[model samples]
Target: MLSMPLRLRPGDDLRGAIEAVLREHGAAFVLQGIGSLSVARLRFAGRPQPDVLAGDLEILTLAGSVSPDGAHLHMAVADAAGRVSGGHVAPGCIVRTTAELLVALLPGHVFAREHDSGTGYPELSIRPVPQASAS
Candidate 1:
């Protein structure tokens, strides 16, 4: 397991920036943990409305995984109000305060994105990689 501390600057899209980090790192192998992100957008499944979060909202919880290409990410975020929301992250979520993230890289694991016949959204697929492989 690896821990990463990330601070999103003002005007930075919370989810997009996270995915960018994964891309910069190549393949994570595994996303073991994340915590404390301020002013994030939480999109709920089955609901068209997305919550634009900001200000003193303690990150109640966060859960998600990154795609093998590192360009896509799926996550759930709950704010201080105890309301939980998540979905296919879009842009425009600015970091009002700061975001600190913890990520784990699994050297032997690989996560990729493929279109699902049912959902139509790119879904994550996991596979094992040779120890020396990079993607």
Candidate 2:
């Protein structure tokens, strides 16, 4: 596994920035670490409007996987009031100072998202990446 560290600057959409990295590498990666966000736009499962959280919010937990197809990230953040809220990471989550991230890449596998008839959601479909020919 290769570890990648990223620092997202202000005005960057959280999810979009990360997904850019995944596409840049042209592979799948596992996102792991604790980060901070000045503003959070989280979409709760089944909720119409996203919970727009602002201020110095501590990202308590962040976990997800990014594939060539898309990203599936879940995060929990605590506000200044100590109230914690989280949901599927969405766009418009602008960063404040910065957002630190750690991602791990697995060389052997490729990940893709496909529509699942049962869950009615796009789910990850993991496959073995073909080995490249020797130079």
Candidate 3:
């Protein structure tokens, strides 16, 4: 695993930015993230639509896995009044100040999303990288 740091500026879409990193690294996991956001789009448990929180929000926690197919991230944030809310991180999480993350890249494996009949949603599929012969 290769660990690297990522920083995002204002107006960056949190999920998209992380997905871009995943695309570059092939497979990676976000160990953690901290930052401020002007807007937060989060989908609560069992909700089809995401709630948009717009204001000075502080990211309390962020962690997830990122594959070339997509990202599955969970995040918690605190509002100006100290109200905390957490849910699945969605797109349009625009940065207010900055977003700093530590990502671990997997070099010997690949991650893909495959539809699972049991869950009725696309799920992560992990596979090992094929070793090449030196002959």
Candidate 4:
């Protein structure tokens, strides 16, 4: 497992940025943990959940995982009010302020996405990625 530290800029969508990184790096498995900061435009499933969170609050925790293709992402975030909300992240969620993140990359595996009829969303299936041979 390889780990990298990330600092999210202001007005950026935390989840979106992570997904972008996964796509760029071709990460088969990604583990994002230990985030603290503020963000806005929070949503759960398909609906907005801002009412459940206080205004411009500090993110006590922000954690999630992503696939190489960025098909599935699960995340949870807490505010200064101590209220936590999370789910299958939706699009358009933006950062109110800033966030710090730790991203782990797995190179030996490849993540493939397929739609699950039961869950109604794309799910990841792990596959082995062949190592590069010395030229």
Q: Best candidate per TM-score, number?
A: 3
- Where in model 1 is the C-alpha error above 4 Å? 29-40, 48-57, 68-88, 131-135
**Candidate 3 structure quality by residue, lDDT tens digits, 79-120:** 999999999999999999999999999999899889999999
Task: Give the root-mean-square deviation of each candidate in angstroms.
Answer: 4.5, 2.1, 0.7, 3.6
> Can you tell me which runs of candidate 2 are displaced by over 4 Å?
132-135
Tell me the lDDT of candidate 2.
0.80
Model 3, residue 38: what's the lDDT?
97
Name the 10 consecutive residues with the lowest summed lDDT in model 4. Answer: 28-37
Which residue pairs overlap in candidate 3's backbone? Answer: none
- What's the true lDDT of residue 26 in model 4? 56
TM-score of 2: 0.86
The CA root-mean-square deviation of candidate 4, after full C-alpha superposition on the true structure, stands at: 3.6
Itemize residue pairs with steric clashes in candidate 1: 43-86, 68-111
Better of 3 and 4 by lDDT: 3
Tell me the TM-score of model 4.
0.71
lDDT of each prediction vs. the true structure? 0.60, 0.80, 0.94, 0.61
* lDDT tens digits, residue span 77-105, model 2: 88889999989887777777677888888
Clashes of 3: 0
Model 3 Cα shift for residue 32 (angstroms): 0.3
